[model samples]
Target: MSIFSKIKQTLHLMKDIDLDALGKLSQKVDLSEIMKTVGELDDRQLAGLMKMLKHKGGKKGQHKLPPIDGDFYDMALKLSPQQRELQIKVRNFMEDEIKPIANEYWNKAEFPFQIIPKMAELNICGLTYKGYGTPDENYVMEGIIAMELARVDVSISTFFGVHSGLAMGSIYICGSEEQKQEWLPKMAKMELIGAFGLTEPEVGSAVAGGLGTTCRQEGDEWVLNGQKKWIGNATFADVTIIWARDEASDQVKGFLVRKGNPGFVAEKIENKMALRTVQNALITMTDCRVPESDRLQKCDSFKDTAKVLRMTRAGVAWQAVGCARGAYEAALKYTKKREQFGKPIASYQLVQNHLVEMVANLTAMQTLCFRLSELQDEGLLTDEHASLAKVFCSMRTRDVVSQAREVMGGNGILLQYDVARFVADAEAIYSYEGTKEINTLIVGRAITGYSAFV
Candidate 1:
């Protein structure tokens, strides 16, 4: 070929070269000198240069990631019209209202009392119960609400879980018809607040079996005396459901301990490293007198408390999914905009690997919680089923949050980046509801027919 024609062909091939990548390549090797050397070559050498240029430019197109969706499996498509509306309502409230001040409140370790009325306006408290102004929907809806609240702030979700799932639920599941009528309507309206006081300094996982707090029937009142620890919402709750052992029967019973009782003091636990916004209290009941009418008549034994745990643990699993989801979503968005080596770090193979593992674990957790709610709604849920979900989802969530922190580098640990909060809150979820060791044994007993707990 003519010399002029050869020069024109080389310029055309150079148009496809990624100059940025080529500049990086230049730093490692003599790209300018290499081009000069290439100009001296025959047609075979020129063809080889063209092939090298195309491969180095990442095969001619930018790498695209699938949309950053936590619900990778489209689980929301299964929701009914009403349920879908409820999800949207809660999600919007969380994203618009809670997301703005979540880190703010969490840093200060204070509860935002103002949001109570706003949250009540959603009419979602006591979500699954069938009477006394509750929505009476289903467990799936309840799980979705928990996830939506947690997607922005786990402390907020935990607060709600304590009031709605534990306290109100204790009344719903174990209260008599009179108790339900008197409490559920006001609690549902959010006019009166509630708390569940079960965990104590001496007992947590074994609360269902052995409680340190003692309750004894005396005349028209039951006298309760013991200390309860990690009791969320207890500090300000209008009524805190205190579970204590009935001394006469040696069985667990629930008492509606009213606020301002002379003998009930709920001191807020301070300096928490996680879920700091939740006002967990150390409650000490000294000669606390509760009327017989205030007793949860249905709770004659620890077996009744187990029913409450079985219901609430599933909500905890969903909360874990939300925490992982929030971190993954934040990391994904940050990676795409965060530039390194003259390109988005998200384009790097290792970053994508972290993201994939996160999404995979997230999707698995979401689906597992979904099925868990199904079993709950179907009345087929067991303690072991809820325990398995709590164990798996909470453990996976810790891994997901850690990877999320890794991808964000130094910013991952900072509250402004939004992922750091999840990293911290994940630790609380992993330990609460039942520790990893306790939950695993519960499942082990079910599958292996052997009690591992002594």
Candidate 2:
């Protein structure tokens, strides 16, 4: 018989079978011709076919598995309907737009500048900030957005955090009203991108005491001199918030250093194993003259700088949660698909044990961060609250991603598998914002009144 005739016959037989049953049977049956013939069926015939699909199983048409999502706690449901929609919008954007090209851009260590406008359309920059075109969302929404963004690509999240949380946050928290009015609006719109320069070549954890970078008052202008290392987004940032110790006052101050300023130079840091797409710059400032007005007006000391860090550090912890969730979800899906011996590897006890362990840690981290964001929204959050979460979540994420990589076996290390990127990115998350040792000490100080971060 012709292919159409064969398909018609098959559809006739399948008309009484459950759709799920038909699906499973179709996998084993040579139904190609039947499928072709069914394509030619009229609407009534198709409806009849669907009706037939309803009776092949017990009571239900077919037993299909639930969606294999990693949000085990249904945290997304906690968001407002609008917030949840925004979450899905970002998730769709990441899957459709970023995932396809993530490995390529990561391998080349190049930022995908083309997606900037697309990101701008999300209206997420300065997510929690008020005024100046910002969203004025709550801290939880901000954390959720950061988590969603990092779930697909940590580099993009880092780039955005530097711009919205660190750079603009510095202006928002420490800049004078005039400065905020001048900069926050343009930045909120992404018309101007920003960077934060704080860590120095010679000093990192010790930055608060004194940085090698120095700003000397020179009458109408301040001459900045020193180098900043690992300054994210600085390579092409329109404005960099350079933090340096004032030579006379011995206090750290913030300067709005414009791009292409004659005395400022930024070279991309290369060969980074983590967050390669972040465009970290080793910045050198030699007699860079910035106007006094450019000085962060309300920033009297390093205390002001710490205010911004305290705020963004919570978001970093949320990013760690995303990294863990992404890895765990990838590994779980891989286990279900990858076959070994006579059946799927997920059926193996050892593999299931690993999956359980990953989920346990991931769940704990998620719960911790959720509460942290809640405390922040309630205005009860402190540096120790954020530091504790950062230290714990980042540390736990390292373990989770490692197990995720382990579960994938050889494919775990392959970039195409997706878990490898999370593996590499976890290392950077562990070290940045605050190292485990440092953040732990901060929490230690808060709890026991002892400072060990000397």
Candidate 3:
């Protein structure tokens, strides 16, 4: 190789070094003399110099970063011993059982059905629900559990939410005593898996005002006909809470549609980019006949369904905190270890800015969700409170995950690193339960004393 060629190659390599640090170094060192030495170097010597520049940028450095934690405010310290134990238990289950296979199963877009019984043993299902074989824990504990589940894997947390929060919650809040007796026990035991089906193919944000599914009271039954989309756990749930508008009353009602009740068909939704481990199903109910006894008698209108939503929406906010917490922690660890210019990238001011922003957003979300759950437990949680939490947390979670991905650079898109999945899953969380626009308007209506919902 020509001597001139080696110098050119060395100059190209110098571009990647931290320019600000390099400028400082130039003031302390004789760069012109260094170039004079470099121009005179033999080919082998130049090659060695280039290697040093590539790996260490011609400098040696060491750094010590504190242990990575997303809970900047130590929010967990407020938890009771039992609540903390429950949180650790869920976190261990996720890190031990789920984290190992999360990416692979997510790549295949399939649920790990084997974990269902194992998860059931936690006895955390329906934790906040009172009576009928429940731990009857507070809403704060339930929110913590949701956060722990999502911290490791968002999809599993989502599956649990659809069952424990939505389906069982429907039976708890809107079902008759007989209906609860028949479903809640087996469901609490995880013997009867459940799904909540309210979203329709053509309606989402407008579902409250315009549910496409309809049902009519027959002689001894109700015949339901419509399609529901993006229903989590619908494929294998033992029973589904199907909400449909009644033809006569024109109000929404809930029914326990058993898996194979004549015409209920659930096809797996494919090619999803987010929450792939969840078995979301596109349901087609063609004159699906459900017995009158299976109906949720207390579900008199969409207002009743709103009750279920208001309860679970707070939980969704907690899940958003988990998602953001996971992403921020991952990025923090990566930045601490990932090196540039012979030092951890986290040492750089700009990179620290990104990490700080992520944790700031995460901490804000955690404190907000804490209060949101407290309100829920105190029976002071209103639709606007839940909606505000959902809005702020879900929106901020996106920002945190985006920064998590950005700090990782190209590797952020690869699922092997886990941040990629968080990034993708955050998108789903942002859109589900309620979108930002819809939830914002809910809060707007409450404060302004006027409905802005279109």
Candidate 4:
């Protein structure tokens, strides 16, 4: 109503306007003409204009940003609509089903058997294999599924990887047509859970050259002897792919050892600090008899074993990405909500520095794995390529989870915070599949002409 009141109100509204933006707008519109037009407005019209400007161009704009996603490069946008749906489907399943009970089962050192049926419903097992009831998706989709599962629970991801990638993969890659038809379809349907037995007590990284488990062929049967350590899902897996050295040939051979074999025993390895929910077993085979038909016909040597590892190793790299992503996201969300010195800890320069480093490493790992999957789909992926990704992603994931713990302070060690679990799981991931030293040597041998593994 009054000119003075309108002038004062305009000044107050101007305080909220972004002056730089207004200056840019001035280049398009004549400021003097705009002022002349505004001068004629009554108090009500002035108030309405102020509200509109504040809503649109105020210092704190009215726009609400979507939540920060860990996939910083928007790689999911590259997925086909069908692949994208599957990715979201798996993510939601992990968040809704596994996340709630992750800590509980993890703390108790028990696998959640109830989830098997529900997880089977996802129909994601044997993801890359073309037949035997597989979905025939690309390797990228397979990697995304692995990342999604590990993002929520590394233990569950490991379980799935063992069954889907290693066990089913051995059959798909090395089994005879009859063997694949008999086993892969049921395993894909989750009717027959599978496990992989490769690592031995006396041999780990050096398993390629020194497999202690021995397989001796008899009449239409092979008798297996010696032990397998850290065999995931072995305790209850319907079938375990046992890799043993042929006593006659000295080359490695894989056998499909069914559960309930008279001489096969799987004792749960307990008291693990990492991946506690995974039921890793120390397996012993004493004269275990497997029929010749049960042997993976194509797997006559260690190179066949390496074939499976090369494929699964890439998935492990993606799992590392998920583990880091889960930790980084948890840390970022925690720092934002957590206050120190009367403001959010995330507002502090040092805290932001750590977050920036974590995100940078996370982004690098994601992009690298994406390209690695592309190579896989293109059939250009090699043992060294998978080894490089496994080494880099696993090593970086340790740093990311460590930073997550450091930012959380005292709460970092507490399992309830979620970051602690990732911190512990990172250790296991670093060692399993292949140690950093082993993987580094693989890359070393690839780039250089000489081998330094000895």
Candidate 5:
């Protein structure tokens, strides 16, 4: 038969098929001009059309698969569509750009500096702050972004959080207007990275009330001398916000210590097991001279520093959620693809139970972070509020990642499996912002109306 005649015959056969059925089926197909051409079908053509539609539907149904997400609470969906889009954008960036390179960088204990420019394009630095080239987004968006970043790699998130949230937030909240205009914009643009040097070698949680680092004022310069340990991004940051006890006033004051300052040196803290990708530094400030103008104006005591910690601690909680999610998703995907006894292990009851527990923990963490963010947005978030979320989420995340590693057996330890990285990164998160003991004490103080952190 001629080609045109065959086409005409096919059209004639389709005539008897219900156009409505064909139209409904057409929605599933990607064919061009399908509805316009449906009018020309005959009975036999319609039978053939129905057969094709059924086959297509069957194939589509067979190919349809559940999303491989660990967010059992649909936390991302809770965001406004714009926030959700931003979340997906960050996820894609992490998956496409960070995931492939994360293990390599983590193994080498090095930060991927090249990704900074790409990250800058996301326009999310200092995300919750107003002005200073910042996004000025809500706390929920900030928490979601932090979770998205850490979900792929916690080390990267920690580095970013230390720079953008802790250091920059300190300057924003306590610095003079001149200081904010001078530093916040550049830091917001990622041109100048920042670090917080609050924890001393001798003081960890006790630094708030009794910091060993002391700053003595002489003339127009403040002389700072002390040792700070586990200062994230300190080795490469442009400025380090050094919180020290002012010898004259007996109050903690923040000083912006510039990089390459005389008597200021940050040695890389080597042999770290967790968040190895972060370049934590042990900094010694021996007579480090900071100009009086560099002092954070409103930061008269430890209370101001605590405010910045309160804000960033919530972000750390979200980071824990991300870490748990990364491990859970990795384990879920592995179980589905990995076979045991000639069948996918995901079908096994024990494996399913492990996944169920991981999901349960993950869902609970997400919901808690969502509410935490809500409190933050309402300007009602307290140190205790953030501490509760941080303590709970980080502890749960450690459990989730442990289970994730457990289900994968020996393969879980391998960096290529992705769970191993989350496993390691979770440890750093648990310790960095505030250790579980410290955070719990904060909550304890709030609930009991007494300070227990000493």
Candidate 6:
């Protein structure tokens, strides 16, 4: 309000820059005479003087960019405080831990085995399951966790999904009480890794129709003879849940096949372009003998297997959302920093169009996965529900990643740029957990009351 007060305020604002310089200038200029002249100025003149002083301190007029968050809908706001905390925890873990090594391991086509102990500290595995050293969280939290994990690296997401969702899910849903007690606790703690063995080289989408693998009871043990392809985490997993059709009852059954068995061998699948960081293995079982007690007690038929797939399919939908989110955010940041013709590319209308489309798709995916997860948690989820989410999200993810790549130009194709990896990984997400065509038919069957694929 006062002249001396205003000058002091101005001086305080420029303390970092002008104090020493002003002392140096005082030696040359008559500082006392200059201050007396400046005190005569009006309020507006003082304000202008303050602005000039502030400018000298730093270039503070530059526009600041918003934080890179693909969740445009604020979906996390809908989460309970606890769930939100966990979501942030998982997100920080992915960004801090996995993002650094993602490209390195992906280029080598190898899984980072060292991350297990650090990941175990998160205490998030088997998040939705109750008891057996699990979190017993809701389906929404589980889906959010899926999104957070894949938001940085889809290979790790798939690896976690195969272990926590598919493999552990199978045991949780189909195994007997004893089996769950033995395996679920250790798997939940990351002490023992697990892999799902359902897709054989010969049978994939039609595994429910019949598995190529055969299992027959011989005395106290069942003999399992078959090969499973594209089995994630199989090479190093302590155990794999092998699905085989019973030779006698013609029913699909699950067996807990431990590693190091003479009859079981897992060879890593190599030279993969997509999801390279996931250690997919070709598992061969010859006369693999397992006691009947190890057989999943409730898994009497393929319907049980379908149950596990249906639940995990929703998680896959969430993964698609994450993949698209990462690509969108990456492209958005790159475009902001990337300039062409005298202005930033992000300032161009066409480039903004690509970004808008990516955000729109990403938002749709987040909202849809939320409701899909709600249905699952509410016990109202059907195969059609999961299938529709998988069909739509995976398809939209492909489009989003493509646009992301397009916006980056040639840099989009390179691994260092990150969009290229999303482009490749999106393809794997599109094909796995049920392909687009297969999922579409599933939704068609529900609405039309007729099975198109069958």
The lowest-lDDT stretch of 10 consecutive residues in candidate 1 is 50-59
Q: Tell me the tens digit of each residue's lDDT in model 6 across 267-375.
A: 9999898999999999989999998988999998999999999989999999999999999999999999998999899999999999999999999999999999999
Model 5 agreement with the true structure over 1-454: per-residue lDDT tens digits:
3334434434543554678977888788854566445545654564466445333323544754455777665455355546766787798899899999999999999999999989988889989998989998999999988998998999999999998999999999999999999999988889999999998888997877688889998999999998999999999999999999999889999999999999899999999888989999999989999999999999998989988998999999999999999999999999988998998898899998999999999999999999999999998998889999999999999999999999999999999999998998888888877889988998998899998644
Clashing pairs in 2: 7-34, 15-52, 18-53, 18-56
Top lDDT prediction, candidate number:
4
Between prediction 2 and prediction 6, which has the larger lDDT?
Answer: 6
lDDT of 4 by residue, 1-454 (tens): 4454455445554764679978899999898777666777875587578656544532465544235568776676466546766887898899899999999999999999999999999999999999889999999999999999999999999999999999999999999999999999999999999999999998998998879999999999999999999999999999999999999999999999998998999999999999999999999999999999999999989999999999999999999999999999999989978999998898899998999999999999999999999999999999899999999999999999999999999999998889999999999999999999999998999999679988
* Candidate 2 C-alpha lDDT tens digits along 399-437: 999999998999999999989999999999999998999
Candidate 1: list runs displaced more than 4 Å: 1-66
Which 10-residue window in model 3 sums to the lowest lDDT?
57-66
The C-alpha RMSD of each candidate to the native structure, in angstroms, is 14.7, 10.2, 16.0, 11.7, 9.8, 10.5
Model 1: number of clashes? 0
Q: Which residue pairs show backbone clashes in model 3? A: none
Q: On residues 1-454, what C-alpha lDDT tens digit does candidate 3 reach at each position?
A: 4546545556665755778987999999998888778888876586578556645623347433355667777676566545666777788899999999999999999889889888998998898988888789999999999999999899999999999999999999999998888899889989999999999889999988868999999999999999999999999999999999999999999999998788999999999999999999999999999999999999889999999999899899999999999988888888888998998898899998998888888888999999988988888999899999999999999999998999999989998889999989999999999899999999999999999866
Displacement of residue 326 (Cα, Å) in model 5 is 0.3
